[model samples]
Target chain A: MSLLRLALANLFASWLTSVVNVLLLALGTASIAILLLANAQLSSALSRNAAGIDLVIGAKGSPLQLVLAGVYHADVPPGNISSAEIERWQGHPRIASAIPLSLGDSFRGFRVIGTVPAFASLYDAQIADGRIWRRPFEAVIGSRMAAVTGLAVGDSFAGVHGLSDDGERHEESRYQIVGVFESTNTVLDGLIVTSTESVWLMHSRHAAESAPHQDGVASHDHEAVQHDHEAKAHAHEAKQQERDQGQLHNSVIRHGDDITLLLIEFSSPIAALTLPREINAETNLQAASPPYEITRLLQIVGVGLNWLNAFAGSLVIGAALSIFAALYASLRARRHDLAVMRCLGATRGELFNLLFVEGLLLTIAGIGVGLAFAHGGIELLSVWWGKGQAISVSGWIWAESEYVLVFGLLLAGAVAAMLPAWQAYSADVARTLSAP
Target chain B: MTAEKNRVLQVEDLEFHYDQPLINIAKFDVARHECVGLIGPSGCGKTTFIHLIAGLLQPIRGHIQINGVDLSQLSERETDRLRGRYMGVVFQRLHLIPSVSVIDNLLLAQRFSRTKVDRSYAVNLLEELGIAALKEKKPSQLSQGQAQRVAIARSLAHRPALVVADEPTSALDDGNAADAMRLMRTLTAHADAGLVIVTHDQRVRREVDRVVNLGDVA
Candidate 1:
């Protein structure tokens, strides 16, 4: 038997204490590893979803909510902005491109976004089957959406009124799945894309059916009144009828002649410098920078994560302390045993190494168990969050700071072992052997 | 070297004191393959003398030469190496590492000495001691007599030039004590190594070729 084997055997002799040390250290390691994986995934997901998009302009509300909803598809949109306002922003010479998103509907909890093809191109999404939506009722499903809903090309499903599966279904408007986009590893993967007119037409038909009297007046007035005074009276009545129609549409659709938000890219750096301030200051719409808002969100989350990390750090310290106590106690109880070893042929350094090897072995076992726990937790989370998309968090891609953590734990273990090892090294062999 | 050429152990004016004199010897020597018994009453420093000769304790003013090397002239590490290579010790307490099996305890000597482990030789030594079947057993599982025999086997596993056994049979009955002494003497004689046994039991004196009574030396 080698020194390491002897050390291992001795550790197993007091298996309960070793197990306690292993468990505490494993828990600490698992927490740290999980924290790193989650932080990395969150940062990557945020950056990927927010890339190439400079500003999100939506109805006045929380800027964070706007980015979370419009950019990440994770929350309800703050409110909707008018299509006229979106077109006005699109026409600005300083704007490179503006993509208007018409939301407020979902199928199986996956959002149905009404947008032009530019929205798909923004995320580098390509249709993997059939073709893009070319008509009001035709829809293109993202790869994740198709996999989750089991809706392939040529399948048809009705949209739900709100951005959740339990919302009221619009049974009158059946949208046929015309295509499915390939996986883009972005928020776009969880969307159903249709034309803006589809949302408007579906809600407009509901409005017309619920308020037939309003439509009757506009149609009937056009058939009468030939004289100038009569024509003026008819025109006035029509204007009032049109105003009534606008109110009915707004009440039914929630956003009158409007899209949910505008995704804006600046043609010049000057637009980034000037636009958000001007828009938030001058218009009813709120303009938000995606990168800034996401950073603020992460900073808020980092506070709690820091506290969790502190708790894990304390556990690691406790593990090391436990190792020290166990070794010291064992060394005290095994004084004669060590003296015997010395008598047999072991030097002081060899005895010291025996104890050191035990500590190192415990730490290594704890790390292995902790890594397994972390990876298993991440795998479960990935399966839940990404569903059928299989977002994997598997790798040894540790951050530089994580390397410091690993080395620091090893150092702590070594330092913990060193004290008892020194005692073993300098033990009075003759006195110990002579003792009863 | 010339003076120590035929002696496995030699001592000259050995003295050890801890606030007072615990041991004092004017001269002592053991020739190769000789069995020497050290006899003393309690508190007479028989164990102390053994420790001094084994280099576990440094003498205040003396020379302890084992296998032609002076123990006082060597560093702690050098002395440990020399002891591991040339001297084997059996403590009175039979201090076997309780966590390991008997065979592993035997192998531990080879491991610490950085010598090649020979399982066949260890097995043969255990068979000679009549504890071969108990090699796989832990020290805690063995009887008092059996554990003492295992400790003896471990000490001699490296086949040292000198074997120092301290009260190896103190806990045994008369019959068991005689058997242990005979086994120790036979094994050391067969290996052609000198043996130093420190004991107060008068029954052990008959088994040794010479007796050094610490009462006379101190």
Candidate 2:
């Protein structure tokens, strides 16, 4: 056996100790790798979903909640704002675009949003099938939501009264699927898009049906007039009337009627400075900057990620020390063999390399197993997190940061080996060999 | 080549110091193809003297040469290289690498000594030692006598010019010890190397060409 092979063999001779050291290292490396992958995905999803829409204007509550509700559609909005108030910001000189969203009902836990077609274009959304909604009560669902719900063009589904599937179904107000969006990998992928008028119509029908009947669910059953030829005819009639009533519905926005929020863009950097302040101060609505709120949210979450990084870093350090202890103890047991090697004409450097290479082998094996385990961990999380989710997590992404982690971990391993190697290097060969 | 024709080992006016002067030899020499025995009572600095001869310890005042190369003139690093290339030391413990197979043990000696790793020659040495079939066995798997044979095979792997053994047959029964002494004599003669053996046993005296008492040297 060459000295390298001797190092490898020595480790194998104490195979149980070697395996324990390797497992500790793998566990540490895996944790670091997982942190790197997960953090990158979280950052990408946060920034990508918040692109283009500079500010979110909604009811005054948590500015974070306003951004989460209006930008992400992941939380309840504070409340709705009056349409006259929405019209106040619509044609303002500082405003580039003010897309209104009316949120109330959901289908199968996917939000059925009331918005203009500009909302889809805001995400650079492309149609994957059929066409965009042209009238009230016709919906174009996000591709991911479409796949999950199994909704196709011409299929009709009624809105649920709340955000969750367990909510009361608004059976009187059925919206037909007109189109499906391409998977944008953005927040838009989890939503169903219909015009603001469809939201008003769904609420109006629900109100009309619920007013007279004590059992609101019995008054408009979910199992009626769905996909029948008569239902199609009735849908066709409703579409024609809604096309005529589009302008009339604009005037129907009274002092009592309200829409959810406005996602506003800036005409200039000057408008970004003025508009959010003007809306928040002069008007009774909150305007939260999407970039500002997202950064704040990430900073809050960054603290937790930092803790996890520290925990993983400590684990790596612990693994390094464990390896050091194993090598050190093995050196004590092999001192006689080492003295014999010296007598056999192995130089101090050769003996040093023997123990050093053992640590080196353990480090390489641990790093290799750790990286693989980390990537596998990310894959499991991706599966548990579900595909095409808002977070867009993946295990296969190879970041430069992971390479940096490997380099750092390798350095830690080298340091762990240095003590035993130094011991081997400076051992008094004659004295050791002469000992009984 | 000239050094090989002269003597394999030489020592004159040697003094080795530890906390005290443990070794002080006035004159010693091993001619080409000779077997020499070092017999002394326990605690007579026999191991210390051998270690100094091997360049594992430096003499405070002495001239020691292996194959006519001066140990004092060379750096400790070069001395180590010299020792590996020209000599094989068989310790009392027979320190073969415990996890490696017997054949690999010989290869390691050649590798550390910077000699050409000759597997066929290693196998031949094991054959001469009569442990050829045990070539693939680990040191842990070898019997005590078989382990001694493997150690002898490893020391003679590159056919060094000088061979040193420390109490090689002390732990063996008389039958195994006699067998070991016969093999040592046969192998040293086959390689034409000078041999030095340290022992406290009187039974070891008849196997060598000359005897040196460490008490008389001191």
Candidate 3:
């Protein structure tokens, strides 16, 4: 016989309306919750993967492609830049460090990257066992790569000839897994790291075998082989329009001494302003700032995100209206009940509490179910997504803005119920009782 | 003056109006344990008169008293408390919450009276009314006579000082009306509560101890 008990009974008495309102509110809340969590985690991972490197120096092409491929290993590298030219930039006063990424091959679906031991420092990477590659053809597998490929330390595997999974296998020089990089939750977790020499040796021998029967004879001098290899690689690339990108890529695996891109760090903030401009303008290679390209990418992507956010916001507004309509119609129908309660000695304030509490229950049930559904869905997606390998987005991270969303919607529910509650509060008992 | 001391409800120079005056009374009183019937034709403001006595409507002039407290002297909040604690009303159409059971309707009145919920007394009332088996049944499920009996139970559940019933027998056939009149009188007498029956039905005359004609307002 408590007012709350009475209110609860009233709410459940109209179970169909109550259920529909809860679902509408839940849909809106879940939509916004998913968007907020996805955006926050995606932005975090993107920024984390692109940490440290100020600029990416590569063959002249799209800066975004260079940044994506170079920093994230997510796309195709435009082509290659000469190591001698990169070495010259390494000596520049503004350039603090230069890490060369010599890309060309893959084992299973993961890329096998040829980089110096110092490349590990960019991510603060640690080797979990054994050691970094000491000799040519030795490799350190990333933790995720190790888990996926099931490659153990001291194991060897021959790589395919392209950046992708389906490529011509190169059996002449197999890479031995010398160590495993500890999980860093970055793009590095999906790559296999080795000395630049291993890539050079593999491609030169593969190219020698492609032109006839020159596979058995080994070349000892990197400088000599690179000089001869680039001449033929460029000649094949010039006619690349005749064939597809993947075939042309496999055909041009000529020199590992010529790297795909140079990851550059500036000595100071002034170097960031001056160095990329100098590198892009003064040389054949293009130097793209990772942060700049990432910002531009997000700006283009943000338009879509904003539209989706607006769509979700409209759902929230629609839900508020739904709850209002349900409550208003219910109170109008229950006017007699309101008058009866008044006649039974219930005060105006008590009547208001009764209706307001009804609104509050609907709002809370909707928000609670919506948040639970949103977070639960993301947790499941994370499992499936971790294996798919783009960037790691966790459901465990909660955005501060979701708290605001919940509070704001609760206030909206209160506003929606306000007029009807007031009508009930001001109901005339004598007139209501006499009405037929 | 001695009768005034025993009065459960007293009205003096009560005047209320909407455009033209709807209710005008010089004086009326229902002493303790009395059963008074106020008889009038339709639209004679019988319902309005009972509302004024129940403190649901404030008189434009003069005042009404319930349990010897001047209703006009009490705050609106206090008036509501007074109505819950000292006054009981049964309308032509019952106001039992259709969502809850018949027994729950009685408990609702008891709860609003700010009294401890007495479930045993509510069961006893239903028992006295011969609807104890229907205590858990919703109002919508009951027959009209059963529903009326539930309404009577609601009004007197809190043992109020005065009970006002509006057209309680108007909707019933003669047999049901007789049974309803008999129940209201006996129940109020058992609680030592004064009763006011407002009706257009002349058939209620023999059941009442006194009769007041509302058609004599002029």
Q: Tell me how far candidate 3 lies from the true structure as C-alpha RMSD in angstroms.
A: 6.7
lDDT of 2 by residue, A1-436 (tens): 6777898888889999999999999999999899898887777777788888899888888899888888888888877777776667767888888888888788888888888888898889999999888777888999878877788898999888667777888777788998999988888888999888777666655554554553332211112211112322334346547575544342233334457888888888898888888888987889999889988988998999999999999999999999999999998888989988887788999989988999999999999999999887888878887754755677788867988998998999999999999998999987777666
What are the Cα lDDT values of the candidates?
0.81, 0.83, 0.83
Stretches of candidate 2 above 4 Å error? A82-95, A121-124, A208-258, A302-307, A388-392, B1-4
Worst 10 residues of 1 chain B by lDDT: B1-10
Task: Judging by DockQ against the true structure, name the best candidate.
Answer: 1
Error of 2 at A432 (Å): 1.4
lDDT of 3 by residue, B51-88 (tens): 78777888899879898999999988898999999888
Error of 1 at A195 (Å): 2.7
Clashing pairs in 1: none
Error of 1 at B107 (Å): 1.1
The predicted structure with the larger DockQ, 1 or 3, is 1
| Model 3 lDDT, full chain set | 0.83
Q: Model 1: C-alpha RMSD to truth?
A: 6.9
TM-score of each: 0.88, 0.88, 0.86
In model 1, what lDDT does residue A48 have? Answer: 83
In model 2, the clashing pairs are: none
Candidates 1 onward: DockQ, in order: 0.75, 0.72, 0.68
